[model samples]
Target chain A: MTDRLSSQFAFLDEIDRLKAIERATPIGDNSRPENSAEHSWHIAMYALVLADHAGPEVDISRVIKMLLLHDIVEIDAGDMPIHMAHDAEAHAAKEAAAAERLFGLLPADQAAEFRAIWTEFEAAESADAVFAKSLDRVQPLLQNLAVGGGSWIDYNVTMDQIDTRVGVKVNRGAPRIWQFVRARVAPFFSASR
Target chain B: MTDRLSSQFAFLDEIDRLKAIERATPIGDNSRPENSAEHSWHIAMYALVLADHAGPEVDISRVIKMLLLHDIVEIDAGDMPIHMAHDAEAHAAKEAAAAERLFGLLPADQAAEFRAIWTEFEAAESADAVFAKSLDRVQPLLQNLAVGGGSWIDYNVTMDQIDTRVGVKVNRGAPRIWQFVRARVAPFFSASR
Candidate 1:
């Protein structure tokens, strides 16, 4: 029991480094780029608070689980914002390797569970996964919208890109949030375009 | 729909300020003090991962909700470390007021739901609340223990104080974790005593 608990704690310790892994979006206050830890935290809260808007069969608890573990890979692979990534395949491969190494620190059963959650999130297939993905996309979009497209401006992100990447996921899982996104992001993207 | 969505977003924006509210304990790495946002996130993760160890009949989902919303009041009341505060009643009043104002930023339904969760955590009578409280206590204790009693040593915290304040809670909700805490923290307190 002690050894197993220590392994779990070791895994937790490794992921604490997520706090230092900065994401593309600035925090709402624009104090600095938000770290992955708080990003996961914020989206988990979003999942619970907005679960009603998700698809009918979506399990909110599962979505929250996926959100919490989704970014653990960034602890090793480092964050490559979807907007900035040049090659999706390469990024996914790197993240997969990182997930194996990081989650591997846990005891066997926990390692399998964590890796399965990460894999399920990456697949984004089920109702829960789709809703989890929506919350994930919605968080940075909210951050960008609140801060007047802080990262969007910095990275020169365009409307079509946002529509294609983020829009589809938000639309599929939580159509109401997609409506909000389209309406809210229109002005900034219009001016930029 | 737009109005309610905006209200929800407004609440989300308000809680983002939690990232700026720092706590006494450092991250596992000892890099710097952990902020309330990450602290909330870490503990929520802790609650999920350690749910099996909690007492029977505890509702894990409810406990997760409690953990996520627990420190949101800190966004307004600011973090008062358990070891430092001298007045419990004064702290509760400030936190209750803060919870009202902060959670109230959400739509009426969400505001009520959030307030209920926050209030439940404060009461700490339910099995879920007791379990949630255990994760809350264990997180900082682990952080402190990992960094060689980071906050405990700084605050000159003693074994008796920890026993009264944190040990009892951890013991009730998760006996295994309490055992780990006792074994791990014993050396530090022994040296100090």
Candidate 2:
């Protein structure tokens, strides 16, 4: 029992590092770049608040779990902003390895469960995973809009890029939410142009 | 449809303020105080990783939801440290109003659900709520221990204070976890003395 709790506490301690893994998206008011831990919290809240926007098939509880676990790999693999060009194969490999190492810190059964959820989220295969992925995309986009084109301005991101990269995934999971995003985002892109 | 989504987004933007509301406890590295939002995320993770320690009657999903929604009221009423002295009636009144205004930003149904979860968490009545409240207390204790008596030193906190204020609640919901906390924390206090 002691050993089991020790392993769990170690895992908890390690993931506290997630609080330091900074994302490109500046928080509301643009005080600083949001850390992965806080971003995870925000997107989990997004899943709760926007559950009505998800497809009927999405199980919100599972979606919330996926959102909470998704970016934890960022603690080890580092966050790759969607607009940034990177080696997809290499980053995927790094993320896979990170997931194994981080989740492996837990007891064996929990490690398997957590690693599987993280994999399911990465695959975006299930309804819950898709909705979770959509939220994962939506948060940064919302942050960008909130902070006067945050990160979009920094990365020189364009509408076409956002459409293909973020819109497609979000629309696949939640079309109504995609419509809402387009309505709010179109003006920003047009004004910037 | 747009109106519904707009209210949700507004709530999301408003709660982003939670990341700015600093807690008394510093994070693992002692670099800065942890904010309410990230602290929420960490405790939700604690619910996930420490679910086994909770009572059999506790539902982990509800506990996670409770943890996520628990501190949101702090955005409005401000965080009152457990060890600090404050007027209970005033704080509770302020927190109730905060819950109403903040969760009310969601669509009507979601607003009610989120507010209820927050209330349940505050009440700590059900098994799930009890476990959720335990994680909420457990997290700061863990953080303080990790940072070498982080907040305990600052607040001039003593062993008895922690036992009454944190341990009893954690033990009610998760005795094993409370045991783990006690074993680790004893060494810190002993050394400090």
- DockQ values per model: 0.71, 0.83
Tell me model 1's lDDT, rounded to 2 decimals. 0.86
Residue-level error in angstroms, candidate 1, position B103: 1.4
Model 1, B1-193: lDDT tens digits are 8888888888887788898999999988899899999988888888877776877798888888889889999987889988896688888899999998999998898899889888888888888888898889888888888888898977888999999989988898889989976888878889867
By DockQ thresholds, what CAPRI class is model 1?
medium
Q: For model 1, give the TM-score of chain B.
A: 0.95
Find the 10 residues in a row with the least total lDDT in model 1 chain A: A7-16
- Candidate 1 residue runs with Cα over 4 Å from true position: none
Residue B103 of model 2 has an lDDT of 92
Best by DockQ: 2
> How large an RMSD does model 2 have?
1.0
The TM-score obtained for chain B by all candidates, in the order given, is 0.95, 0.97
Worst 10 residues of 2 chain A by lDDT: A48-57
